[model samples]
Target: MMRDEAPIHAGKSGLRQILRVATTADHRVLDALGTKFDLASRSGYAAFLSAHASLIPALENLLDKGPVPPRWPQRRRAGALAEDLAALGRTLPEPADVPDLASPAQRIGALYVLEGSRLGGAILLRHVTTAQPDAPVAFLDHRSGERCWATFVEWLDGLDCGSDEQRAAIEGARLTFAAFAAQFRAWLATIA
Candidate 1:
C-alpha cells in the first residue's frame, strides 16, 4: 500500500534541496557534480564523499604509474565493457554515434589495468586536458594517463595509438561522458 502524504523537507538551502533529491535520482550525476563543486546537499554530500573516499587509495595506486605501464590482466578480445557497449548500441536508434566496439573495450581494460597496477596508497586525480578544453580526465591516477572523455578515452590514451586516432577517440569519449553525466543529473532530481 502507498501513503498519500505530501513530500517532506528538512529545510535545506536551494542547492541543498537539489542535492538531497539528486542522490536517489536516476543518473544521480548531480551528486557527483555537486561534490565536485562543493555544492551538495548535507545528507547527499556526506554520502558522496563516503562513497569515493574508499576508492581514493585504489585510484591513487593507478595514478602512481606515472607514464609507466599498467598492471591489469591483458584482454586481447571482447571484454566486459566492449560487450556491454556493443549491446547497448544495437538497442539504440543510431549505433553510428557509438564508437567502435574495440574502443570501449580498450577503455575498460585500461582503467582496470591502471587500478590493478596502482600502489597500496595510490590516489586518483581529476585533471583537465589541454588538448580538449572541456574534456575532463576520467579518474586518472598516473601522470601519463592523460585526459579522456570516458572509460574509452582513458583506455585509448593508455594504449599506443597514433595522434590523429587518439584525438578522435578522446573526442568520442568526451561526448559520451557528457551525455551520461547530463542524463544522470536529471535522474537524480527525483530521488526520494
Candidate 2:
C-alpha cells in the first residue's frame, strides 16, 4: 500500500510516513491525472512516455545537482525513458518547469516521490508489456525487480527531520507531484 492508500501507520515518526500523510491528496490527484492516457495502444504508450518525459527529466536533473538519495544513480529512468521513446520512433517532450529542490531536505522529499513511483511501475510494466509487447519498454522495465524502494524508505525514515527540514520536504514533494501533474495535464491537452 502506498503512503496514502491503506495508510502505512507503521513508523509513524518517520519522514516517509510524514510525507505520505502530507502528500496523500497530491499523490492521488497525480495518479488520476495519469489515467488520461489509454495505454492500450502503442501511440497511447508513447503519450504516456511523453507525459513522464516532461517531468522525470527535470526531477532527475535537480537530483544530479543535490545531495542525492541512496542508489540514486541506479534509480534514474530518464535515459531508459529516452531509449524507449527512441525505440518507439518518438523523442522526449520538453521538460516542465524545474521544481526548486534546493536543500537536502527538499531533495529528499523529491526522492520520496521518485522512489515511491516504482511500486506503481510494477503494475504499469505488466500492462505496457502485455499491450505492446514489441514496444521499447526500458523505462518501465528499469529496476522492476529490486530492493531499492525498501532502501530508500529506510534511509528516508531514519533521518531526524527538524521542523525546517520537515517543511522543506513537504514542499519538495508537493512541488514534484504538482509539476508532474501539470505536465501530464498539458500532454493530455495536446492529445485531446
Candidate 3:
C-alpha cells in the first residue's frame, strides 16, 4: 500500500503524468507533468518530444537507471548515405503541409552532385598537401560532409562549369536547393 502511494512505479523511468490542459487544444498533453518536474530540462525535453513523439515512451523507459538494450545502434545515422538522407528529410524544401517523397530520389540526386564534385577535389587537395595517410583521414573525419555540401552549393552559385549549357544546369540546381533549404529550416524551427 505504501509503495502504491510512493509514485506507483510505471515502468523504470519514473512516474509521469499526462495532462489534457484546457488551454492547449490538440493531441498534445503535458508529458512528464508532475509535482517535481525539473524546469531546467523541460525546454530541451519538449524539443526532443516534439521531434520524436513516437519514441517518447521508449526514451523514458531507457532513461531509467540501468544498462540500455544491447541491440540499439550507437548512432542513428551510420553511413554517409544515411546521413545525407536524414539531412534531406530535415533540410530539403517542401510545401507547408505536403508529404515528402516515398523514395529518397531527390535527396540522393543532390548528394551525388555534391559528393562527386567535392569528394574528388578534397582527395586531390589532401594528397597534394600531405603525404601522410593520417592527415587525409583526419581531414575527412573533421570536414568531409560539410565541405562536400558547401562545394555543391558554390558550384551552383555562379562558379563556371566549363560550358554555358553545363553552367546553366548547375545554376538551376543551386537555386532550387537554396530556396528549398531556407523554407525547410523555417518549418523545422516551428516544430523544433
What are the Cα lDDT values of the candidates? Answer: 0.31, 0.83, 0.29
State residue 24's C-alpha deviation in candidate 1, in Å. 28
Record all residue pairs in model 3 with backbone atoms less than 3 Å apart, i.e. clashing: none
Give the local distance difference test score of model 3. Answer: 0.29
Ordered from best to worst TM-score, the candidate numbers read 2, 1, 3
Two-way lDDT contest, 1 vs 3, winner: 1
Off by over 4 Å in 2: 1-12
Kindly list the per-residue Cα lDDT of model 3 for residues 1-192, writing each as its tens digit: 552123221232211111111112211122212112221233322222223222222322332222112222321112322232243343222222211212222222223222333344355445433543322122123245554444433433322222332323333324323433333344346544
Question: How would you encode candidate 2's per-residue C-alpha lDDT over 47-158 as one tens digit per residue?
Answer: 8889889889878988887666677888899999899999989898877787888898888889898889888878888887788778787887788778878888888887
Query: Could you tell which candidate, 1 or 2, scores higher by TM-score?
Result: 2
Task: Name the weakest run of 10 consecutive residues (lDDT summed) in model 1.
Answer: 90-99
Model 3 / residue 182 / CA error / Å = 3.8
lDDT by residue for model 1 over 1-192, one digit each (tens)? 332123322232321222223223422443355335221233332222223322333333333343323333321111322232233232111111222224432333333322332221122222123222332222222323432223333433345444343333333333333443543343334332
Report model 1's TM-score to 2 decimal places. Answer: 0.28
Q: In model 1, state the lDDT of residue 91.
A: 17
Model 3 lDDT, residue 121, Cα: 37
Error of 3 at 103 (Å): 20
